[model samples]
Target: MTTPAAPARRVPEAVHRRRWVILGVLMLSLLIVVLDNSILNVAIKTISTPAPTGLGATQSELEWAINSYTLVFAGLLFTAGLLGDRLGRKKVLIGGLAVFGIGSALAAFSGSPAELIGFRAVMGLGAAFVMPATLAVLMNVFERDEQPKAIGIWTGGVGLAIAIGPITGGVLLDHFWWGSVFLVNVPIVLFAVALMLWLVPDSRDPKPGRIDPLGVVLSVTGLVLLVYGIIKGGRLADFTDATVLSTVGAGLAVLAVFVVVEKRSDHPSIDVTYFRSKVFSAAIAAVALVFFALMGVTFFAVFYIQSVRGYSPLDTGLLLLPLAATQMIFAPRARLLVDRFGHRATTTGGLVMLAATLAAFALLDADTPIWFLEVVFFLMGTGMAHVMTPVSVVIMQALPREKAGSASALSNTFRQVGGALGIAVLGSVLSAAYRTDIEDELGLLPPGARHAAGESIEATLAAADRLGARGEALVGEAGDAFLHAMHVTALWGAGVAVAGAIVTALFLPGRTPASEGGDRNQELAPAAER
Candidate 1:
């Protein structure tokens, strides 16, 4: 009699060993992309430590360093995916690695904020090409049947990159300069270029139609204005400020026009009607909400670590280990969970977990021990890992095989939108909280101390350290208030997560996982299908 154990054992035995090698190549390539994200956060203070080009850079420049890459990559994703289909995935992927390498080189030696932002934008452009290509190439290489396992591994790699980046960045910055963060990417990209050249096959959409240039213009402009207003909201007095409102309005209008252009294009950058498909739309929506909450936690948590909690760069990164680790550990399990629970249920549950995790984060305080935060961070990461990988699967499975690139691009675009809005919405909440509290305290102080009070949490802390007087401890009081405001912001983040959970739960179907052994849907979300 054949037992279940034999089938399980035979399945592993039949698996092509060479696929793991290809996976190794894919993982390294992807690691360079995601690692660039968290590593920069670690390098922020270190990079601006001494002020290389002139004197210390303005706070806006600091914001640009991170946002420049995020905005460009998000904006250009659709075009990059289309270009890959036109040019060939492997060729574009290889070229992107080279371009990314060059951008990293430039970033490593950038003398000014302008140079840094420009190079980072170049990096973003490279990343846009790389992101879609990685999944598409993997989709092409793995047969219809073997995709879920491969994707799970691939998603795990993303989680690993995320988890390890801060620690790696911290270690690098300790031994080398902040430039080391960018410098690190050079070797990795070089390695990826070589590995991809040797291992990956050249593939693209076979009968691709026209390329949409106008759509590209509109999407880029829209994302830039949207993200700019978001990141810069704190420096401004009003959200309704004419420039901010106008920029956001133009962005939306351009994107609206772009949508019309694509729907009519012989070769549309994206299939606008994909929203009509339940799986595709639901998958993207879930990711959008999930990442929205994640950004709120990650972005401001970093601020909390360095400014309010007073952790050093290395310490802050180490503190984030739980966050990354949670994502990594759960990514592989996400596939099995989804396999059993079905897509809608799995994703919705993930959303609930994410919301709960963020709600837990709201309980953290200046006096909260790091150990407690570590556990909470781990839970947050686990929930997020599940939410991301699974939803990605649903989107991929719902689309035509030839349309994976464009489908992936749109899914990612939603993620960027969610992240940008999270930053804007949650960040604005924090700013208002911070400004109001500080202003209230400053009103009691003499005019001389008001400027110091109006400064950021970091500046206030620096001032408090230098002041050393009991009566004139304006900076100290401001620092406390800063921590308080950040705490309130965490509550706002939790609220966003709750909203996301409800939306996901409401729309996502509660079906039992279908036993489509070699289903294309499973292949769609590379990480989630695992």
Candidate 2:
């Protein structure tokens, strides 16, 4: 007779009792990672200014500062998750927090744009380990029935970071130099580390797979090459450049090889077979596409509010309050909608709402009422809350409890990769469009400066400033160019969101019978496994 299978492990009662507190600690850890990005958004203009006030970095350099963090975070997340599963999550969490704190300190004192970008990558390495570990530990501590509720609350923490990051950065900018925004993270990291050591318990997979070093190398290499090419294309505003084509083509080729290698590996970092389920694949795709649309739109929205409308950083942050408020209000409650309408209807509806909000950007101009933009932001946040909560539940619930680390890693990797691409692609679109519209007006500057001025609205404005009273006409022209570019990028974002809606409607499951109840694990299992 075959040997009996081992019984499932149970969560300790003491651990169960303090699960909420553990979640609170995990959120605290998550806050600093996300907070850094949001704070950077509000400070981008200051960072683009000349020395003393800012770094004097160009728009392309600024995009690299953001994408460097995201690309590293995206590329290493799967491997980091596997490490957490093999070792202990608490150990990894502490280690990651320490690294992030060190990176933040180094980044705060960076003397140049290149140094800042390099330091941001170090922070990304730490964030890769922290993000998946939080969700994985939560999965282990909570019962399956409670996982959805726990994940919803976890998703809401992202909104909390979004709420706090910009306003905090604005306040810091008002009083201190731009570096203060990064410096603020050090104290929060220290506090979070203390709380994690005290409250969060260690957890890991009982039978972890071997480390796939080759797979890790291939994935990171491919992603960096791919993102570098995309960013380069954006900087040149020419996707057809010989260098762009070669790098993008090579990146795609390597990633294809990675897929083939993983398919044949006995102990892959990511189990490629799990994606056989249509529902699982669709859910992950939805996460990626929605972020792709939203992140791209947000990249331009900051400039539109600050540079075009002439709002101070603090005012811009306050204006964004509606976005964060609606997310916090609706994120946890999204589960109610999922229970009533099912993931298919809920996610599809949310994407539709998101698409509408993105398209509404076309209606905005320098003179539009501020309240009108706030309403759009509010609705956009509501839609995002619904989509994120339900899809996170779907992705996390699809895997076995033992594979929670991998599950969380896969979900987050796609989200980060999507966001990174969005910023690169849409930022390029905005750049190209702005250049096309403003090139004629740039004739007032020297030929050497005209190309640089045409690169971005900020660059244009800086060039115009040096011209004194003679540059007043160029300022009005720059605003018009940026608004036109924003309109074009918004429509592109809306189109991508609509594509996500269609994918969800076609592949995500409809309502299940009441008899099935909370047994979503079995329901979402791959057909091959069944």
Candidate that would win on lDDT = 2
The superposed Cα distance between candidate 2 and the true structure at residue 88, in angstroms, equals 0.3
So what's the TM-score on candidate 1?
A: 0.89
Report the C-alpha displacement of residue 494, candidate 2, in angstroms: 0.8
| Candidate 2 C-alpha RMSD relative to the actual structure | 3.5
Instruction: Encode model 1's per-residue lDDT on 315-381: one tens digit a residue.
Output: 8889898888877888877888877776667777777777776767667767788888888888888
- Candidate of highest TM-score: 2
Error of 2 at 2 (Å): 36
Provide TM-scores for the models.
0.89, 0.97
Evaluate residue 293 in candidate 1 and report its C-alpha lDDT on the 0 to 100 scale.
72
Angstrom error of the Cα, residue 404, model 2: value is: 0.6
Ten residues in sequence with the least summed lDDT for candidate 2: 521-530
- Residue pairs clashing in model 1 are 151-526, 335-530, 389-528, 392-525, 393-525, 397-521
395, model 1: CA deviation in Å?
Answer: 1.3
Overall local distance difference test of candidate 1: 0.72
